[model samples]
Target: MKKIKTSPLLPQEFVVENISENEANIIAYPFEVGYAVSLAHPLRRFLLSSSQGYAPVAIKVEGAKHEFDSIRGMLEDISEFIINLKSIRFKLKNDETDAEVTYTFTGPKEIKGSDLSNEQVEIVTPDAFLATLNEDATLTFTLKIYQGIGFVPSEDIRDELDDGFIPLDAYFTPVRKATYEIDNVLVEDNPNFEKVIMNIVTDGQIGPVDAFKNALEVMYAQMAVFNSEISVAAPTTVERVDETPEIKKLMGRIEDLGLSARSFNCLDRSAVKFIGEIVMMSEADLKNVKNLGKKSYEEIVDKVAEYGFAVGADLSDEVVSAVKKKIEAE
Candidate 1:
C-alpha cells in the first residue's frame, strides 16, 4: 500500500505577478495536489456570475415605438440600436441603484457612447459606437441605467416599464473573462503540490484585480454560512483583574497629555479623542494614522510611558467599557 505525504491544505501564497489596465494574472502555489482546482473553479464561477456592474435596463428612443420599429435617417434599425446600447459599459459614481441618461444628436454624424450624459454614472467605454445618422436626421433617446449582478432577462423588467420604453437584457457582470490552469509543483521534497494560475479580464468599469477580490469575498460569504452554527469556545490563559479606576484615568481627554501640535493634530484627525485609545493601539496601528511620522510615534510612546502606562496594553473589555462609560458621564 502507498501512503500520501502530508501537505498544506491551503496555498502558501497568492501573488499577482502580471497586471495591466483591465487584465491580471494571479498565481497561488503549494496547494495540496487537488486543492488548487477546488478553489479556482468556484472563484472563476463567482467572478463571472457574482461581480456587480452597471447596464442599461430600458431605453426610450425618439421616432421608434418598439424594438422592431424602423426610424428614418438612422443606419441601424431600432433592434440594432438596442444591441449597440447593450455593449456600452458604465459605472455608478454614487450610491444610486439606478440612473437616467439622455442623448440627443442631429447629424450626418456617428453616435458614440460619449454622447450619453449623466452626472451620477460614468461611461467607461466612451468611444464605443452606438449608431449612425444620415444628413438632416435627428436622434434622441433616454436610457434607464441599473446596477446589478449577473444576467437579467428583458422579460424580468418589461412589465415594470412605462409605454414606449423598450426593455433590454442586461449583462451586469464586470468580469469579461475568467479562467484558471493548474499544474503540479514541488514543495519540501514533495512533487505532488499544485499551483493555480488565474487569468481575469474585466470591462473598464472595474479593474481585474478588484473583480477577482470581489469574487473571493462572494465565495467567502457563501462558505461562511456553513460555519454559522459552529461556534467554539475561546481559551482563557489568565484571570483578569479589576482595573476600572486605572483605565478610567487613561480614558481622560488626550489634550491633557500636552502633546505637540503636530502629533495632537494627527491624532485628532484620526478620530482618537482619549488617552486610553492611544495607549491600547499598537505601534503598527499608530503608524497607519495619516501624517503621523516616526518621530511623532516615538514621542507618543514616551509620553504614555511617563504616565506609568505603555502602548499596546491589553485591558479586559469590561474594564474598557466601564471606563468609557464613566468618561462619558463626566
Candidate 2:
C-alpha cells in the first residue's frame, strides 16, 4: 500500500510575487477575484482620467503671417510634439502663475519640450520635439504651463478673452498604462484547490498596492452612503412573532434566498431565528442588528419583496408619517 502525502493548506491572502522596473505580479489565494476584477476597471479609469500632471495650456506667436512657407508643417509638428508631451509626467518645484513666459524662438532647428523648461518647472521628456523650422523663423510667444486633472481646455480654466489667446487643451493624465490578469495555479498535492494570480501594472507614479487600496476606499465610501439612503427609506422595529415550523424552514437558510455568498456570510446566526421579525424591519434598522453592508441589505430587501412583504411593511400609516416628519425636521 502507498501512502498519500498530505500538504499544508495555504491561508487566503495577497502576496507580491515579483516586481521589475515598472510591472508587478501578485497572488491572492482563495479569493472570489470577481470582486477584485470588477474594481480593477475603476482603478484603470481613475488612473487615466483622474490622476494629476502638468502641460502647456496656452501659447502665442508673432513675426509671421498666417500662411507662411511650411507654416502648416510647423503647426503639425508642434501638434505631434504636444501629443508626446501628454504622455510625460512633469514635476513642479514651486507654485507659478498661469501667466505665460515670453520666448523668441528663431528656429532653424527642432524645438523640444526641454526648451520650454524654466527654474520652476522641469520637463521629464526633454527630447520631445514641438516644432521644426526649414528656414529662419522669429517667433516670440508665451507658454502657459499649469497642473490639472484630465484634459482641461483653456476656456474652461480661465476667462475667454479674445486677446490672441491660442486656447490649447492641456493634458495632465499621469497614468501611462494599467493592466491586470487572473490565473489559476494548482496547489501542491491538491489539484482540486487553486490560487488566483492577480497581476497588475502601472506607471511609476502609483504602485499596484496603492491603486488597489484606493479602489477599495472608493467602493466602501459609496457603499456607506448607499446603505444609509436605502435604510432611511425603510425602518423596522424588533418584535416577537409566532411562526409555524414550515415558515421557519422556508427562511432558514440565507443562501436559499438567492443572496450572494459574501452578503449571506455577513448575517448573524441570530438572523435565522428572527426571520419573521427581520422581514418586517426596515433595512436601515437592520443595520442595528445585522452586521452587513449596503449590498447585503439590498439582497435582504429583494428576498423579502419576493414574498409580498417589505423590511418596513409592518409600520402603520401613522408611524410612517411620524418618521417622515421627524426626518424632515432633522
TM-score of each: 0.67, 0.49
Best by TM-score: 1
lDDT of each: 0.83, 0.55
Best model per lDDT = 1
Shift of residue 281 alpha carbon in model 2, Å = 49
Question: Which regions of candidate 1 deviate over 4 angstroms?
Answer: 1-9, 232-330
lDDT of 2 by residue, 158-192 (tens): 57534554556777655455566555544322334
Error of 1 at 121 (Å): 2.8
Segments in model 2 whose C-alpha atoms lie over 4 Å from true places: 1-29, 63-89, 95-99, 153-162, 185-330
Candidate 2 whole-model C-alpha lDDT, 0 to 1? 0.55
